[model samples]
Target: MMKSLTHRRLAELADVYGGLFHLKMGQLHMVAVSTPEMARQVLQTQDNLFSNRPATVAISYLTYDRADMAFAHYGPFWRHMRKICVTKVFSRKRAESWASVREEIDSFMKNVDARIGSSINIGEMVLGLTRDITYRAAFGSISEEGREEFLKIMQEFSKLFGEFNVVDFMPWLGWISYQGGNLHKRLDRARGSLDVFIDKIIDDHLEKKRNKKNNEGFDGLEEDMVDELMEFYDENGGTSNLGSAVGITRDNIKALIMDVMFGGTETVASAIEWAMAELMKSWDDLNKLQQELADVVGLDRKVHESDLDKLTYLKCVVKETLRLHPPIPLLLHEAATDTVVDGFKIPKRARVMINSWAIGRDKNAWDEPNVFKPSRFLEGGAPDFKGSNFEFIPFGSGRRSCPGMQLGLYALELTVANLCHCFNWTLPDGMKPYELDMNDVFGLTAPRAVPLVAIPSRRLT
Candidate 1:
């Protein structure tokens, strides 16, 4: 098997061998599902059977033994965590209460405006904005040094999570591979750093709770996620309401914090970077989107969340970017019991990988699968990112679909729209539009191999 560019290789293999195929990775039985029909069966029809996550060394060690919602086994604990995230963290009300998103974007645009006329790294700028916004949303306000350190740790965690360890596939060779590659040491170091950072944040939250308790009349303050989760912890008598379950512990809170930090930051940043890369290459689409923006939002003002709905073309561009470059190209699942999918027998504990990248590019599902056309989504019967349309699921479908979908889309659309609306972007050094490098560095999220450096001139009213 070709180890590098594994997702693309899987797409090519699926093209030759049809939608469903089986392979063996050491002692692991693996199934690759690429087409929409197969996706429906695994994600919707037999979702329960394939709902559990396959344990990986990096994920298990970094995420507190799969205590996080994303990697937790499909069971009561998962349900409990998912409920907390949906209701307390990512609820529509909670998303709306974070007015800091707008404030952060304003700061971002000011930084961009300051660098006008000179080439700037748009990828880095987008990453900075997302990281700041996510940090603020997760833990109110953080110092510059704290934010920088947290971002560094998250980067290392993402890199280590995506790494391929031989011990994952062949356990018998664990001692040799673990000692020779220092995989255990690396995982331990990353996990330890993250735990310490999150622990401090949690302690701060506890202190704030104590202060809030002391205050008699303090209704003006807004509760962040930690406050909400802490409230739940206090209300439930320090026990998770899920019967007979070990209550939500400090470790669980830290694990969920890890999820929010990594999930909210990396994926949204990658989407924005990819969208900019695509628009940079496709001039017509860029112009069309700008025209829509001008018509919807005048030149005197910045793009607001309220204005996003009227700018349909901008939404389509985001959808198109997601289709071409899904953050997580392959969604992971594990079979909980022996089952048959598309007439192929899948054994219990088999690892299932749904190649969303291939599904988006499937010839039968999309016309000109390789093209970067946003109009496809503007047609009368076009699909959406809500996961109902299997062919267009940038976020996975069914039970384990991303709980942060609404918040993520809000961030992606807002950032992309403002960048396109406020400035006319040009490649640095007069490079041709089509010459932009679209190569991707694959990991937990696939970001551009080359950071996008472009010149931005404020658009005239």
Candidate 2:
């Protein structure tokens, strides 16, 4: 299996080679853990030794050499960054405080309404919805001039992060791959684009802050993510009172902003798209969800955030969908030290990949693993995806678990709930439920390989 280590191929290998298997790719020693027990060992039991992330050339360059939260080395700086995100940026109060999410969803519904009776690419539309929502949350407004281009460059990051580089696996022959300089050129272009775009955003935010302080008429725009991050930065030279040995700088701010943009948009979008696709292919489940929505949030109006808690079936659909189509199928980590896990030796710096995708579909962990049954989650003792349940870790576990999970889930649940409550969907071109394509394209996130094309009819009164 040295050819390619795509999640699907690795999962297939796990079926024959067992839960934990090792592979030596050139000079790099890699391990794949696919079972719940093995995954727990890597993600929970020995979490500290595996908390660090493995960076590719593209990731290092694009994220300003791991200054970002997602790939930052596990330490005081990473912890402080994550604390800022959890407490200030993605906290429960912060998530609910954003009127941007509601505004974006409303805008999305209106667009869908306009397309009623015509075929629409649900996946593409959902991606746009998520991108706009994230943009507003991070940048205070979606009116930035380079917003679309910034998003395009961010999308390019997904491909680059997952792209194969011979230098990564075999650094001894690094010169061989660089002779053509194709990957380097691409990485340079991506980083350069981000620097120009992100620098402008930071400059604008700084100017707004300065104007607000000097009694100049401030626009009174609600403080967005950039404003919050700037609280930690000192314009003079160092950090604010929240000083750190690993000082925060402009690169740090830009990297964190990139993390928010990339992490917040595509992953949530993919989950929403998968939820809708699964519902379209499973009519009974769709009916049950819509019925729940009607009982809790009547057809007279759209779903409100307040009504989300009562939409139990809607939550189940999302959980089941994640079980099958996790945004990042392969959770990447690197060994921080030499360690023995589950009676196996894990050497220092060895690359560890936990296949949450494979584990979610494992027959041993889930009953009728391949079936899309949201009802399974309604059962007592059902596992949750909140870092504790090894069987259902869509956002992953431990320190490196997605810090934006609260915000992402809020977007996923609200968008899916509104889509189902406000409209009824059907496969286009007279396509049968079984005929709809469920294949996924693996990248930084696993989105529908073929965009889900469907027709929407107004179901609300």
Candidate 3:
């Protein structure tokens, strides 16, 4: 069966891993699992111990040893940091504060229109748009100023990290990747960028504070997560030391920004790419979708946030993308304390992999499991993504799940709808449609094995 594993080509994983099993990635023990009950029990029931994040040596070193929110476990400090995001930053009031998001959307459209009549790098382009949104929303800076330098450095770091890092499995050989000082060079670049961007933002905050310019007002930027993090940073004496008077550091806030920056950007871009690939695979699906878009949003206008409800078919396409190529396929949830499930003991600090990719296509859950059919979601039929059905979790469910589901969905809907409504895409240079490879080269975000290459012809608009 192990030998046949490679021969069968390792398609859907739920059928392969079953509930739990040990697979070897060299010396490391790789575990894969399926089922909503199991996921809930591990990530929710034992939320305390099981909410730990699998360590990131690269980011840990960058953050001066695991001070980042995404890398931190469930604890008082993490709680304090997360509150800044949940309450201060991403709160309804703050979201309203950043009304410029629509302006950014307009900027995105203008940029896309510039690429008309030419083959464009949609993947790279999407990253820039996401970065600009995040930078403005987080630090009130575009990704082009000194802050943009930090965004670019982190992007390079993530690109390298998205690759299979052999050192992750063999920590002893971590030096192999940095024999030429590559790791230090990247970390240095990131630190330099952070020094400039975050420092400038913080300085601006202090200046605003000195002038008392809306610093204490209800609608002021003080209610922002960045502002909260800075407040905590100042109260705590500028250190992430344990048992401090305040809570966390400025670096922790920046780390959270990086989390949204990477987690939010790559997945959104990949989802857009996957949606395009799947839609192209089925012309009938595209035409059906186009009719829906045309009815809801005529050719004279473009799809906006308000138009998302009418474009339900396009949403189905996004769901299927999550099914086939979930950005965080092996949703990482580390064990915080030892716990037992189904009479089996999971030791503390064990890495748990919710095989969402495999679960999405489980034959028991989906008909024609291997095929792409956006119509399956036409009715209220299959399990919704909330972990209720457990079969499809493009965004991992439970307490530690992605908090940016709405934001990610917004990017996905607007981008996919606009692309679909804006252009008729095709494989470039006479490439046969059937020859396109859909295989995935798994990464931090599972992306298409071959970059989805296509030409975009703008609509008559």
Best by TM-score: 2
Q: Each candidate's lDDT (Cα)?
A: 0.84, 0.86, 0.67
For candidate 3, report its TM-score: 0.85
Query: Clashes in model 2: which pairs?
Result: none
lDDT of 3 by residue, 342-441 (tens): 6677766567777677667667668887788888888666567765556778788665677667767777778788878877777777777677788776
Summarize candidate 1's per-residue lDDT along 1-461 as a digit string, tens digits: 42623678888888788898988988889899899999999999999999898878888888878877889989887888898899889888885325767888889999999999999998888888888888887777533358889888888887888777777788788779545368778888888897888778778777777776888444355567777777655323344445543457666777788888888887898999999889989999999999998888888888888898899899899999999999788899999999999888999999999998889898899999989999999899998878889987779999999998888888889989999999999898879988888888767777888999999998956
lDDT of the structure predicted as candidate 1: 0.84
Residue 228 in model 2: shift from native, Å? 0.4
Which window of 10 residues has the lowest lDDT sum in candidate 3? 1-10
Q: Across residues 244-302, which tens digit of lDDT does each residue of candidate 2 receive?
A: 53346778888888888888888999999999989989999999999999888888999
lDDT, residue 381, model 1: 91
| TM-score (C-alpha, index-matched) for candidate 1 | 0.95
